[model samples]
Target: MGLVIIFLLVALLAIFGLVRSIKDKNLLGAFFAFGSLAVFGWFAIMTIIYNGFPVAH
Candidate 1:
């Protein structure tokens, strides 16, 4: 539950960062935004692969 919320927040922030970077025409900021999003995706995928979500009760 907690980790899910954390990831959600991170994902949202990354999306916002990407949008802001693009709007500002900042290439470096865009690169960092993509990196952050990629790391969040990695964590999400690993968690799902190991736990299979909701722990099967």
Candidate 2:
């Protein structure tokens, strides 16, 4: 759960970076940000689906 939260937070930051990079016309930065967003977002979603939030003890 904690890992999921951290992943989600990083994904959110990646989203922000993606937007900023696009506005600045920085292709490389946008690419990296997009990659980060995909990886982190996927991990967070998968974790939630597999383990369930507040995971049972």
Candidate 3:
């Protein structure tokens, strides 16, 4: 539950950064925003696979 909430918050922040970058026409800011989002997405996927779909005998 807590993880989900944190993830949502991070996602929102990333979106906000992306919007601001776009409005400011700053490529570096946009890159950072997207890179952070991709990293977060990868972390979420890895966590889900490790916990939600564990392999056991």
Model 1 agreement with the true structure over 28-50: per-residue lDDT tens digits: 99999989988886787677678
TM-score of candidate 3 to 2 decimals: 0.63
lDDT of 2 at 49: 89
Worst 10 residues of 3 by lDDT: 48-57
Model 1 ranges off by over 4 Å: 54-57
Query: Which candidate should be chosen as best, given TM-score against the real structure?
Result: 2
Kindly report which residue stretches of model 2 are placed more than 4 angstroms away from their true locations once superposed.
55-57
Estimate candidate 1's alpha-carbon lDDT, on a 0 to 1 scale.
Answer: 0.81
Give each model's clash number: 0, 0, 0
1-57: candidate 3 lDDT, tens digit per residue:
357546656867888998999899999999999888777767766676666743446
* Per-candidate local distance difference test: 0.81, 0.95, 0.76
User: Which portions of model 3 miss their true places by more than 4 Å?
Assistant: 45-57
Worst 10 residues of 2 by lDDT: 48-57
Ranking by TM-score: 2, 1, 3
